[model samples]
Target: MKKMPHLSFWQIWNVSFGFLGIQMGFALQSANVSRILSNLGADLHALPLFWIAAPLMGLIVQPIVGSASDRTWNRLGRRSPYILGGAIIAALAMFLMPNASIVVSIMPVLLFGLLMFALMDGSFNITMQPFRALVADMTPEEQRNVGYSTQSFLINAGAVLGSILPFLLTNSLGIANTAPEGQVPASVIWSFYIGGSALLLSVIWTVVKTKEYPPEEYAAYKGLDVKAEIDPQYKGFFGFFRLLKITPKTMIQLAVVQFFSWFALYIMWVYTTPAVSQHVWGCEIGDSASQAAQDAGDWIGILFAGYSLFAAIFSVFMSKIATKIGRKTVYSIALLIGGIAYCSTFLFEGGEMMHVNLLFTQVDVPSSAVLWMFPMIGVGIAWAAVLAMPYAILSESLPADKMGVFMGIFNFTIAGPQILSGLVAGSVLRFFFGGEAIYMLVVAGVSMFLGAISVIFVKPSKSN
Candidate 1:
């Protein structure tokens, strides 16, 4: 195999910069969507069902985008057009999401919210799947870990910004955190507008600063048949299925790990608001809009910011030890820590448990939100690994020509599990956990532990 020439650090940074916007959009979506859904009168038990749009839309979009990007070449190059286009659409969706009531005044609020939710997620997947492929497309095998770890850093860094925005606007900028009944708050609405603008600007920076390889040059470097013409029979319609059939084994093994990791994440994104409101702040959020519920929601954004801060600080650093400790071991250990952390949220005892001899614990939840920050440390570690290692390992195994399709297929491991979570989480919450959202976090911890084990079964590529 021909060894691809390594680019300087700034080159890699420029190319990966687009992920900052993509993840910022994602952070805003995940941190706020549940609160938005709750405000629209979604029942606690049905929260997971409302979240179905994101993953299901990704399942439909990623593979198709991936397959299509593999064949496309234009003035914007193979991937930039998709990145640019998706960012614009998703930014519009972001601005419109907080206005769900006004955006679909004629339709029922929840139904309209679902449509907007799917558009945001679908547009995100369009940008996201290509970005993952772009990393594989641009970097050499020896630099894959560095490429992905840097991507992880940017992702969490953007999340830090997006996650904290509403809280900052509410507290520092004096935007109203609470609104009239059935209406979204000014704090969240303003945050979305500013975040949408930032999303577009950040993506534009990447598109302008970076250049993709011309098709012939890329094919030649990857040892593909540069001279071969596309067979007309398989041109437009048959591409995705044909590409799907040829997915690599390492990708399949990694899929098992992805499924569990994302399933845990889906539960976290969909339920964390209500869980924090009820479990920590002791607020009821059904039909009646309480100031306490809004406060709890903003605080949850802070907790998410805390986690993103940890992930950003630790993300790129994972690359240093990934080779030394072994990628699988590092990934597994990180997730084990996260799994244990998720389960420990139940141990808080309301910030003043030192005198209680019956429980026998030293941990005190001095302030309610401070206690929640503890679990994010472990989650940050796992997030770093999940973003970097699987892709670093999988990039080495994928056929260069089909990298996009395989990455999209790999996304199914993410979207498919979240889809399953949507199907199952509500029932499990109502029937098994007696409508407590805290237990769902416990289930997430168990799922992460299982994901850690599954990743160990994957074989590292020869390039590694």
Candidate 2:
């Protein structure tokens, strides 16, 4: 491809706007769902099993959607339609999720909502991939870093709001502080509604304002294959199946890293509240019948927001860092940093009284503030690479025509780790240490270091 003039700042901003909304949904879910599930009476060990729906749905949905979008064309275009569709589905799921505990058989209601959430999530991912491909397809090599950086910025901006919403609403508005047994708080409900609306509106703004280069215009970009050429014989199931075959070596390497990384994250999310409550608040898990459990849930939201806040800031500089060092080396260092953060959870335990400040009558400010803040900073840095590195590497390695399918397969690795974490982390903590939640963080630390080690082996893509 011939070198083109650099994109205007607004051009980069316009193309990346939709991610602002998408991250609102993603951050809310990642930060809050485990808290919601726990409040609804889900056992820690079984929490992962419930989350199974997310990955299971992704496994089925992302590739199919990716392949379909790859073949599609029209006024709406291939990717935009999926983005619009996902926004609608996600909006609906957000509306329904906070109310799940109110319905009959909380487990079933939660599962049904999770399914809807997964559908919406999958659609968003489908739209996301094509936008990424479009950036790579359209931007000059010199500006690719800037384009991706803009997108990551928008993503973290969305996450910042999404992560903070619950705490902001519940604390500031004086919304119903406590729900009846088995019900979600009014603050949480309102937050999801706001997130859903924000998601839809942001996506619409992008759809209306930004224009994708058509196949002919896009073809002008050097090194692009606009023909959408694939082996016609491979349209059938067997042909698709044949393309699906990946080297066992690659699969083993990716699968191991993905498993540990995702497992660690899942453990952190699922157990953080309980850990904080038990170790920091000195509250027994089932002993809280009032607003205490819900309060813990809110703190989790704050911590998540803190991490996302840093991620937004770090993303702006990630590309430069990747360029200065090798991408793999940068990623490895980031994961190690995150691992250190995870392991730091142990220091916060049993030091609650000295750490917390009693600001007002009967009101104690959390003493372990430094513990949470420092790790969150590390998380933010690690997240920059988590968002970009693997996909960047994979994009460089795969053939253009196979991008969607291979990316879909990659999603499985990401989701599979979450599934494993949820299934095992809580039970292991419960069984081994009589329900001490800090152990889960230890597990996460170990897993993160493993992911760092795995980074050493990912060969840099020459094409990229």
lDDT of 1 at 95: 85
* Best candidate (score: TM-score): 1
- Candidate 2 — which residues are off by over 4 angstroms? 1-5, 101-108, 222-229, 246-256, 286-289, 350-363
Cα error of candidate 2 at position 183, Å? 1.0
lDDT of each: 0.83, 0.70
How many backbone overlaps does candidate 1 show?
1
Tens digits of per-residue lDDT, candidate 1, 1-464, equal 46677988998898889888778888988899888877877788888888999988988898889878988999889989999999999999998888888855599877887788899999999889999999899988778888898999999999988898888887777789888756788988998888788888988998898889898789877988877776554456675566567667788888998988888988888888877777776655352268767877887787787788898888767888986887888888988888887888777534432221112122222265567889999888888888888999888888777788778888888889999999999999888987778889999999999999897898866522
Top of the candidates by lDDT:
1
Candidate 1 at residue 346, lDDT?
A: 77
Per residue, candidate 2 scores C-alpha lDDT tens digits across 210-237 of 6766765554554566765767766767
Return the TM-score for each candidate structure.
Answer: 0.94, 0.89
Query: Could you tell me which 10 consecutive residues in candidate 2 have the lowest summed lDDT?
Result: 354-363
